[model samples]
Target: MKPRLPQLDRPVRMPSRSRILAAVIMLAVILGPFVGHLLGAGHGQAATPVEPLPLDSLLRQAEDQSPQVLRQLLLALVMSLCCTAIHLAVTVLVVVSYESHSLMAWASRTPLGRITLIAGTAMVTFLAMFVEILSWAALYLQQGAILPVEEALYFSSVTFASLGYGDITLDLPFRLLASLEALVGILMAGWSTALLVAVIQKCLALRFHRTDHGSDPTTATNP
Candidate 1:
């Protein structure tokens, strides 16, 4: 038989001012894309024709014409990143306010719930980064030829990490976007690691307490 959990020990959280603030910000980020898409659709009706995106068209543009394709691509990427950052910022604010043992409490309530929640958060971040990468690749390919899918993923990751090995050079504006993504990745990664460690420590402390009490229930009661 599966063992029953000891009762959860953390104090309750209530609806409060900070939660409302976070809710509104998160709602805005979650809603922003659809709103932007709607606006884009409306604007596209009146806008001039955009450049084509096939391999031939891109190469033709990149080799002889201006870097407009690359610039446009990077604009989409920047938008994707800004949205991702806002979403993550919302997550951070909401997460930081959570009381001790909360994720563990949720985990205790249901198998894989916490895992799924974390996975969803990761997916959102990666998808946003993917949009950024695609923007760069879209511009690059328009300028030149299509990169192999594997090559594109590799290039995107390396560029985002700012470890540009000089193997995949880009037009000037795209080069700037690569630099910005790299800087963002480094700073955000450090911040994420720190926050993750703090959260894990809090969870681990609760687990340690549970273990101590398991050794003797009265030990917890006495302490």
Candidate 2:
């Protein structure tokens, strides 16, 4: 009788405390504004609902000179920088995961693996943008620009996507934030696209290399 080799089961890796804490902090930043709004309502102090101002009012507010505009611009600058830093950090983490986990090898072995990698990379990018948008929504609420947290977040999402639905409008001071967020969204989308393309290229090259090295049988063999 032939001897059978024993199979070893792969160990599942549990998330470390630091990683779990980081995730919690990310979620808190994303949902804290909404939670606070709910708490305020429960305490018998409901936030004033946001109402769109008339065009004349909006234009007048826009033309009025104030230091609030400067403050808002500075805030926008800081938030943009923070979002950029986070996006870059996420890119670094993705690249690190790919290398550490030998994702290229897995990708080269199967088309499904490559697709999974692409989907995962995209999800990470989406999550990074969500956090940034939520931060801006929280800031808008804090600045009292928008009355309701949900309205602020809705505005943030619309502006981030550059949808410009115009159902809700911000005064000039806070409008600057929306403009900056739209620009950030465009830039981040470009960055993510580049990353996805690079990953695809790497995966394809890995497969080519394996075939050239005679490791993969799909390549044509020289007669």
Model 2 scores worst on lDDT over the 10 consecutive residues at: 214-223
Candidate 1 collision pairs = 58-142, 62-143
lDDT digits (tens) for residues 1-223 of candidate 2: 9999776698768999999999999999999999998898877644565587999998887677457777767898898898889899988988787664345556668778768877888888889989988988998899888989889999988888789899999886677777888898788778878988887776676566667784642233220
Off by over 4 Å in 1: 1-103, 106-150, 213-223
Candidate 1 global TM-score:
0.43
- Per residue, candidate 1 scores C-alpha lDDT tens digits across 44-136 of 976976665899887786686456546645665765566466547745653754433445455434435545545555554556556656655
Clashes of each: 2, 0
Best by lDDT: 2
Top TM-score prediction, candidate number: 2
Error of 2 at 208 (Å): 3.1
